[model samples]
Target: MALIECKDASFAYEGVSVLEGVDFSLNAGDYLCIVGENGSGKSTLVKGLLGLKKPESGQILYGDGLKSTEIGYLPQQTMVQRDFPASVYEVVLSGCLNSLGRRLRYGPAERERAESNLERLGIEDLRDKSYQALSGGQQQRVLLARALCATKKLLLLDEPVTGLDPIATGEMYNLIKLINLCDDITVIMVSHDLHEAVRYATHILHLGRRQLFFGTSAAYRESSLARRFLGRDRI
Candidate 1:
């Protein structure tokens, strides 16, 4: 069954269309990578999925039958985020806010869950350190641990490896693959690099101002979409 469904979705800004006639579904444990140029509405689509923006037309249906709190999101980490004063433990623990809400105290269970998530991402040692003090790779892992604390069923990561070095990007991709393979988490991500997205994603969503493409990796490889947008040499 589909976990997320969008039908005839459309969005616009200042009377200019951004997304139109977008229809797609995400099943449990599926990994979908969204690729597009800077102005192609990739970030807008993420906002739409997160309910941060209202679509001009159509609807998004979450069919996992989960509550709104169950949706987990990890947005791109910008340079400014490097200075966030929170400790790794504190940031990861914040992910439990949707579940814990305004609770006066976090009990043993919540603490355990946070620790386990950190451990799963192999960053348990950094839990007590300040988020601002960690290396780029460490910081991303910490944020990913935070997202894992939100939900195990679905993970939405937008431009996750944007500013990392090549080695860090490769490590991040390996971690993402392991998260999907071992934990069965459905991964939906937005990316600018076609090669990286194709290397890891099972499904691809290509967005243009007035056009888009959605298909499995094999199908995407077989299509001419790469030649037009990514160039033949890159493919």
Candidate 2:
């Protein structure tokens, strides 16, 4: 079954329609990259998928027993978020907050899950370190591990490598791919790098305030849509 589907969905930004006619379905283990220009509503669509906003028209459906709260989301970081004063372990352990629902304390399972994800991301050694003291790449790794603690089924990342150096960017992409390929978690990412998006994603969803293309990466590369974007692409 589809993990999530959007049927002629339309979304608004502060009550003005910004994206419309979106239609696609992501199945289990699918890696979808949402690509668009700056004002094309990519972030708005992510919010809608996360249930942060309701669609202005049409539907956003979730299947396979997936709930919005069950999605592990790693949003674009702001300066304040980057400067957050917290220990790495404390930050990651908070990803289990959604699963805790009426609970007041972290159970053994939650702590174990946090520890496992830290090890999974190869950041166990940073457990007791201060979050703000880490490098940009290391902080992102910590955040990625935190997101993993939220769900085993889906991961939603928005421009995950925004400020990383070339090496760190490559490592981040490799880690995300490993999560999808090995852990079998479904991934939906909003990205500006069309080249990288097509290279790593199994599928692509191109938006320009409206649905432009939806298909496999190979098909997208062959389509005129890819040519148009690549022509203007700096890469």
Candidate 3:
């Protein structure tokens, strides 16, 4: 069964429809990119997928033993989050909060998960450093590790590469690819970089306050939607 399925779903905000006609299916290990301009309901759809908001029409279902609560999420950071005063280890270890359930304190298992994720991302050296003290790329890596600590099956990222340099952006993309392809984890990402989205994603779901196209990356490249949005030269 697919890990996630959006069956003719739609969403609203304050009694007004912001997005409609959403549909897609994602199996394990698939990397799907959601592409659209600002105000196209991408974030609203994400909220639905994360179980934070209910769909106004149809449903978003989870199968293959996956639940929306178990998905690792790396949301776009605000200025306040960027300067959050906490140790790197503390921040990353907090990802295991969901796994604790009724437990009041983190146990060894959660600690080990955090350590494993940090090592997986090759950031063990910065374990004791302050999270706000790191560079943008390093902070992103730390956050990725934190997200990984939360889930082994899937990741949901929103504009993860937003305020980074060219090199840092490339590094972040590579890390995401590694987590998706090598780690065999499904990835659902919302991105503005159509070029990179085409290069990395297995499937593309284009939106314009509604689903415009949903298909393989190669097929998306050939679609008129791609031509209109990315241009032939860009694709």
Number of the predicted model whose TM-score against the real structure is largest: 3
Local distance difference test scores for all models: 0.85, 0.94, 0.92
Residue-level lDDT of model 3, residues 71-174, one tens digit each, is 99998887997889999999999999889999899999999999999999999999999999999999989888888988888899999999999999999999
Specify the poorest-scoring 10-residue window by lDDT in model 1: 63-72
Best by lDDT: 2
lDDT of 2 by residue, 2-93 (tens): 99999999998678889999999999999999999999989889999999989999999999999998999998998898778899999999
Tell me the alpha-carbon RMSD of every candidate: 1.6, 1.6, 0.8
**Cα TM-score of candidate 1:** 0.94
Q: Which stretches of candidate 3 lie over 4 Å from their true place?
A: none
User: How many clashing pairs per prediction, in order?
Assistant: 0, 0, 0
Ranked candidates (TM-score, high to low): 3, 2, 1
TM-score of 3: 0.98
Cand. 2 TM to true fold: 0.97
Residue 186 lDDT (model 3): 96
